[model samples]
Target chain A: MLSKSAARAFFLSGTLLFGAVFIWLTVDTFQRIPAQTNAGDLNESVVRGKHIWEENNCMGCHTLLGEGAYYAPELTRVYDRRGPAFIAAMLKDPEAVYPGQRRMVKYDFNEEQISDMIAFFEWIGRMDLNGFPPEPTIGMAAAAIAIPGGERPQVFTQICTACHSLGGVGGTIGPALDGVGDRFDRGYLMRWITDPQAVKPGTQMPKLELTEEQRNEVVIFLSKQREAGL
Target chain B: MKYQSQKVAYWFFATCMLLLSLQLIMAFAHSGFDVLHPWIPFNVARASHNNLLVMWLLAGFMGAAYFIIPDECERPLYWPRLAYVQLIALVVVGVTAIIGFHFGWWEGRKFLEIPRPLDYLVVVDVLLFVANIGMTIWKAPKMTTTSIVLFFGLLMAALLYLPGMIPTDHQTHDAFWRWWVVHLWVEGVWELIMGAILAYLLIRLTGVDREIVEKWLYVIVGFTFLSGILGTGHHYYFIGTPSYWLWIGGIFSALEPLAFLGMAIYGVALAKKGGRNHPNRMALFWTVGCCIMSFVGAGLLGFAHTLPQVNLFTHGTLVTAMHGHMAFWGAYAMLVLAIMTYALPLLTGRKLFDTPSASYAFWSTNIGMVCMTVAFGVAGVAQVYLERRAGMEFLDVQRELKVHFIGLILAASLFTSGIIAFIYNFIRYGLPVGEVEESVSAGAAAAAPAE
Candidate 1:
């Protein structure tokens, strides 16, 4: 049988050790919080949006800060993928944007409430997470739109590269143009590039304004992309 | 039922059973009915389910202490009327909090969902309980290890609840204090309570010496405090805490299984040494079964994800659900059931241990819970692979796991049946009566110090 004094000593020492470690860890947690959280996270709009999120139990469907329900997408980096306008619109009417799937229920958020939600998303985007969701570093340069140390490219980086990819480089908001020559000749390419809305009334790509020389240069560049199939 | 005042325990346990059934109903609403989405949201249902669980378990522990304390102290309860008042207040607070959850009057913290105003009521309720138990022990002729340990555990549990109430807007800071209540209660102080109850059961069931059993209790308490207090670090690994927590959490939580191993060994060894002397064999079965299953569920399964490397993949997944269901069932659920099984016949003066339903309840509940744990494990691993590992969409992964939930529902059905049987048996035994004349001699014989 164990001695009474031995058991008492063990209990006392164990309690002390446990208390010491817990205090140490708790202090460390407090020290790291201010650095990791974003400055604008505590702003009025962001704070109001946080209350709205909690009141609606959004975390029941979506994950925030790696916690809560996993039924919906992680809302951590949503501000980067779709801008504030898109987020606000989606909150107003989810089915209009995300058709064919009935996942996110439509919340009747007014304009100001929608803006607050966007503000919350924007604030969360700025936290110092040390890269929790690793971003894609490759294929991010504007080389396809305007190649460095050469003649001025026909393609405008602000217009074409913002939505489309060319020669395996650029954005993916629109279709890739790696083999556009196979799909269209120079004549069709010129008309399509000049007035995209006339070709497809509701297409997302905007028509680019170009001079005669710029138009010809863009067509010539597009014609050379057929080498992939050859 | 050595003391007439101990009958107050019956009401507390009855409330436990009532709350448990409600918790199960809410679980069904969550898993089975997709149509109830708008009216009863998932968060409302989940918060109610978890809060009810905490309420009932707290009720169970309170009941067990009331029953065990009077006998261990060799005295009647200090204030019998106070016990009844405390029980009514506890039930009132619990019902109000649960009802408030549906209307969104909740703190939104996991497990500690009761709103700020109701939290004060809970504090008052617990203080009344602690004082009642304290007075009972103080008036006793002599103090025993079993009584002192139980009192300390209950006091610590009350103290730990305060950390969850700390006001904070920072998410990381909130999570830090929340784990102090959650982790410390389960892994730290509750183990002391479980150990004391286990020792009491073993001493009574085995006809073992009090000194030997209490000695084993000391070892279990030591092991629990050594590992479990530091084991709170495991929760800090991913909650935006300092990087040093990863090392501290991983190391300490890895050692947590040792305490559970000690409890399991203590139970099994005591049973083997004592042989089958007690007529209530089902109580012994539940006592020993609780220890072994606790070791497997809380000890081994918890260790699986306690390491930082594994937790990164499995942190908030259904893997946690798997471990949670089993650990709570094996440790606290079975501990309460053991006490009930031991006390029921004595309280009502009915010897109904040899019934077929009693045997079925033991086998079916244990087997069904094990199957449910496996189902959750399979679904969780699949979810981790599809979503976290393969970078699939969250909704798509949830759709894939819908099939596994079918298995969970089936296993839960079986588990529910066993619980029904146990409750039916409890009802048939009727209300608590005064102690039988023969039990007075038997109680003395059991309490006598061994040579």
Candidate 2:
């Protein structure tokens, strides 16, 4: 049904394009900045963190940015998103929070390496990465404060319900925090609010779209909602 | 132009399109270059692309039905109010699904991202139309030029989107079936759409032989869908799929571009051999631009990373994004413009748009598209070199290329402007407006020697 000439033309065009663009991209690639620097950035925290991260093999669950495996959530935003205390606690007790997951193997990371890991997260958190940061603005000030309100639950539904459960109504792709205030103090909430990395490092929760006021109000609402009559 | 019947579908379709375009623009603004952005991920982008395509396709299909269904049936739209309900349902479901995606409650497929709850709604919308379109065509004394192409394209698209909805565990499996929805819809089914609209516009304006045009249609599209649907294999070469996929995908995808190139060369040639001396040139502009873009975006860059060997080096890079960006918006969205071109004139009493303003819009859209494509491609290639193959860490790569990436974003912004200009021009002349004299036309002199 097809003409031989047209078939040949197709081949000819394909070859020409292949040869030309491939050559061009190659040359262009070489001419650009060297593709990567050596992996051996000798900074102490980086090396220590590298050892700890690899020792832990964080890629088993969390992705680093978009690379690695995706069984775990992304750790690329962990430093700014999670706090040291949470990471330490999670490592200390695998099933304390995530009893449902595969029992996380306890890695024997030393204090210095833990600090380095925290440093790694801190470094990544502060990095001026574009194309991320859901709203892409640095905080003006902590607008959320300790607030007393019944309206907080409504605000929580509007903002946090994407992840959190409210009266067992929302999705459980995330954890249930029905009585979190019994364990977590205001400081814990504030750190989690500001950047969870300040409290628990490498948590899977995305930074909430909370204004300081909204976050505080929601926190107050969440903090106080212990059973109808606890 | 209420005509007592078609007004409801048209308005609803138009409103949905305007909103979908806004969502797409915002998604682009935030997508950055990876699937791991703090806000949205592969899941959200998948939803955005799928939902946007769905809404646009629904609107385009409904618009076509409203225009040509009457002529086909030798009567006004069968139950225009029914069509109107379909349009409203499409908007409601489309808006809800898209919001669900952005707000993060969507299935994690690359294309089949309609919320599971709303899937039945989509089926109903499709069913409503199939009955209407089928009946209109069956009932007609004879189908018109445009109705045949459109009826086949949209109807088949609904059929093709099904395989993608199959439940699957592996991402690779999902991606495979997803292409059945996404790829066939664009290259397979939508080609008819694009071809049908082009045929209709040329018929309306160029005074061409419909038989000749129809013949071209018959040959041109068959090859594209045949090769094109299979060509979707290219996407899977690197996603941990089978090895044979490499050769199968690579060759077919390479063939896929040839079809568009053939269409481009042939389209311009046919236009010339056909002969036209008309103003209101944006119709022609949209058609020609669609082919050129389809070739460049889907063809050129698509091959750049289709094979497993190449995809290992280029997958998830900005280059893939560039190709999709151009191909989706440029190929299909612009075809919608082409359809609007003819339909507007026919809808309005004016024979054509005021030439000068249309020219500005045309230039803006083309230039904007070109800028966007090139910017994304260049930045994407740079990213592949720096990140994937080079093995640079994310932050380091960002620090190194921040300025250039910013420039690329600005270029993206400009492309957005171009799209706005396109819609603005569409609204101005395409609407029933009192207009004045001079017309600007492109040299429709045929592509020299169709060989």
Candidate 3:
């Protein structure tokens, strides 16, 4: 049985320890993001967009910076990958983003608000995260498919094999694109190869420069791996 | 018919508890070993532990209540024949459930997963028990003794079970009610059963005033029920629920276990004040130990996690396991053992079998549990340090501390060993309960050599 005094001391120490940790974590969460709203710098377009944002309470549907309800998509880094003009057109008529697909209702906002919405998205894209999630590197294979009698394999093993591998010895930190050519035709592959995430929305996969020759060689090499597997 | 079968029903129940224990041991030990899997295999040890314990406790309660209830009501058995049927159904379900849990066939609900079909068997069995008790109590009105505590308990057991069986599509609501089944019953309702039995047993064995013990029992039940319902608040602290649950959980949960702690201290104090000369020494050991343990383990250690802040660290850790081991053992295990100590000798016509073994078994179980509590606490504290301070990955911490957790397994082994010894001694002396036979002079000469 614990003496009353001993029990009291135990509780006191526990309370102290708990309070200290609680305060530290709470303060840390608070300090992680600055709370100062950038409302002061808003132009006519941005102000109009802000009104739209408030009227609809966009957070009710979408997540912004891991806050708000998770009913809809995250819009934080969407602007960097998309065009400003495309974004404005989507706001004016959202069905343009993906034809015949459900999207945000086209609120009656002027062209200025649509531009401000683009500005807001651009601002969201600029906020830096210190490499918490490492950047994904893809689609810029130094090798390409040969039209016939090609040596694409040698080129691929030298460059593309570094970040991605199939079934064995190589760095496996990236997605295995060993047979991706089989999944798409040449036109689809070209669009995806140009800037990877534009074709696949919200993909962390980045795009880099690849000569037309190298891209075809890599596509041909990936196609060969699938044929051999089958 | 029922009168004749009640004793037999108890025998069947004892067999079931022992068998379930074996099954649990098999699953746990097989998983422990490096090679071949046990009779039932998979990642269902958690389910096995909980389900087997629940079944065994139910069986023990059935057996204990059978003996004590009739005596309290001052009547013959009410449909004793039904008891045997209940036992058979219960054993079938218990065995099947244990096997299912052993084989990785369980959905991972903490307190309420027994696979859908087999759970029906348990419900039927408990329903029978409640009907039997209720009928018996009604026929023999004003039969409020220590036995009557179980009437409310067995009823709640069924009532609490209903929410768990409902399969809701919304996972959040499903999880919410899961806590209602696990936390609310353990915290609120089962204590009535425990209180009734403990007070009755205490009064019976201590030769203490019945009024005093009953008074305490009433208070204990009152405290337990009142605090227990809100005790579910603690679990709501995290669980991906809205933030409003914070205040609802924090205040009420803090109050939940304090009553148990008070009961523990008071029970121990009462035992001390009563002094010695207990008839069933083993029964006394279980009763007293349970009183103390139910408080410290279920009450105090649980309090550490009821807070949202601490639960994030200790939620899935060995700390949770530690409290579970002690609280279940103290609240349910000890209480059942106390009842067994009484009923075993009554059926078998043995007295001194329990007396000599009490001290040794008491020491063994207590040492093992205390060691487990310490080991888990240390491990939990260490885990907290690694996660909160070192900023190590969760998997990394688990990998680093894999060896230290061996202490808990070791403590558990020790506790099992004690039960083995206690059971052996009990069987040797506890069986064949009746008046001792006197020997003739000629046979006495031969008996001297055997001695």
Candidate 4:
């Protein structure tokens, strides 16, 4: 029984009302975005990094803030998950980082560009995205058991764990490091960790660039990973 | 054909077929098919695939408008030569953007990946199109709701493209404004175009009274904006926007399906009510199919994840892809195909509507798309469990999902076959050399009720 004029009135009024509300919400959102997203921390490097991101069409593969193509990993929390050094190393040579995995087009960025990208991601990771990239509720319980070795080294956690599992955790790309001490001694561990391909040609692992102190720290930590007990 | 200028729509449709085939080829390459990976790369293939889709759909819409406006206005198109020029410019701009994407000359945003310079050219080309269509409607002896609604949709779509071009250093702001173009176009103004086109088809194919159909058109589009305007909040929920959008987006987007449901019912009921069936039964099938599938794909599947709770986990996964492929196919792609089915015979003066290939095109494409959605859905649900819930590494999860991509490729191949059949039929129709039939003009006069 609805007449044409009544339907037209409903359309006009509903659109006007909702349109007004949407505009008002947008205005309020802009006002609050500065604090929520830490707008002041958007330095020159971060801005340039955003340009690089757009220039390369990075969103064509990877996602940020839960938008973009689903071909690659979501990168909103990549800054927190993978530290700056690992991010830099990966950007320098993508295939070397995760060889024989899904391919990443190597952009061949210089150090400054890599650092700029890291800075941009650091800024993004600090934003209050209303708790996005949610913590895995079911998997944390299994990964929470204490390791037999002493506290893991910072360098090992940042770089080594990306490919090698320490105990029951880390990536499965390389072998688990649960009993690595039983398999290789401290000197051998140092040599292999520093230059994987030199020791064993055609290995999947790349030669990870590590500082002298960091290399010593990781080797010591791996040496303590005995199967019997620490 | 009633108007000599309507012949121009055939060229537009022809371009659509070509672009669509190119889009599918790029899709296979982007899906890690390996053969084109060395040449195309994932990003280039993705950019080409998505941009080609948008380009072809825009062409189809333009073609549909050109063909329908003249018939509805009871007059020839204004500046028909300009339509040809506009099409050429659009194709040139589209080709440049796709090639530039390969060479890393792009803006890098999703959907709005066209480079900045080409963006300006696109704006100019669209404005020419709007002006040409606007003048035709303006000079008509009598105006109808269908033509006016279609014209308004096109004009608003052109104006909305500006928001995406707004300069922003902050990623959050960039995303915020990009949705203004993407979301608003698909869920908002594009529905207006869909509604008008459906109204035009129902009136012609069903022999329904224009008053009843246009009356329901207002109600359906009324429901569209009432829900869709606020439904923009759904995109804001996770994009660093204010938290209040959680409820605003959730409540409104839940209502989005009602508009689509209304369309489906309207199409079916009108077809049954109007006993006088036009000879173009294939067009009617497509029109009705678009309505029902839009409800299932855009309405139901979209609702499956629009909620804040489910979306918290499924935010950037293949689940969104599942919803997206079907929604675009049902809503926009099928709408264009429906209009093409209706207009092609009239444009070419060939009654090839009820051929076996026509029916095959309809069934195979629908079944293939459904299979594709299922493959994506199974992969997506598994991904949500392994990656989001189980906290697995990204690559480990992807390796597990590789088999699903194989399934997707198989489904896509079937879909492509349907498209090939459709294009084969299109080519078989030859060209638009139809003369104006006096009897068809009388039917057109009857179809257009006095305002």
- Judged by lDDT, which candidate is best? 4
Model 1 interface CAPRI class: incorrect
Candidate 3's clash total is 17
Worst 10 residues of 3 chain B by lDDT: B442-451
> What lDDT tens digits, residue by residue, belong to model 2 across residues A1-230?
44534543553464445435433533442233121211223356764665455433354334443333322344655554445555555556545434333234455666776678776665444432222222211211211323333444445653354345544433354666666766677767777876765567777654544567867776776677554424
List runs of model 1 lying over 4 Å from the truth. A1-4, A39-41, A70-72, A81-90, A93-108, A125-230, B434-448
First chain of model 2: TM-score? 0.47
Please report the candidate that would top DockQ against the real structure. Answer: 4
Name the lDDT value of residue A149 in candidate 4. 63
Least well predicted 10-residue stretch by lDDT in candidate 2 chain B: B440-449
| lDDT-superior candidate, 1 or 3 | 1
Candidate 2 per-residue C-alpha lDDT over B56-129 given as tens digits, one digit per residue, 9 for 90 to 100: 75687577667656643455566667777777787788879878876645554445556667887887888787
Q: Candidate 3 falls in which docking quality class?
A: incorrect
Over the stretch B354-382, how does candidate 3's per-residue lDDT look in tens digits? 55466777788788878878876777677
C-alpha DockQ of every model: 0.21, 0.02, 0.03, 0.80
Number of the candidate with higher lDDT, 2 or 4: 4
lDDT of 4 by residue, B130-208 (tens): 9999999999997998898899999999999999999999999999999999999999999999999999999998778
Alpha-carbon TM-score of each model against the true structure: 0.84, 0.63, 0.63, 0.98
TM-score of model 3 (CA atoms): 0.63
lDDT of 1 by residue, B1-451 (tens): 7778888888888998899899989888887335676778777888888899999999999999998999889788998999999999999999999999898788777778798899989988998899999999999997899999999999999999999998866666777888889999999999989999998888888877888788778877887888888888888765556677778889989999998999999899989988547888899999999999999999999998788878777776788888999999999999999998888877777889868899888999999999999999999899777656654445556767888999999999999999999888888889877664456436634644673
Stretches off by above 4 angstroms in model 3 are A1-230, B1-9, B23-27, B30-42, B102-104, B353-356, B429-451
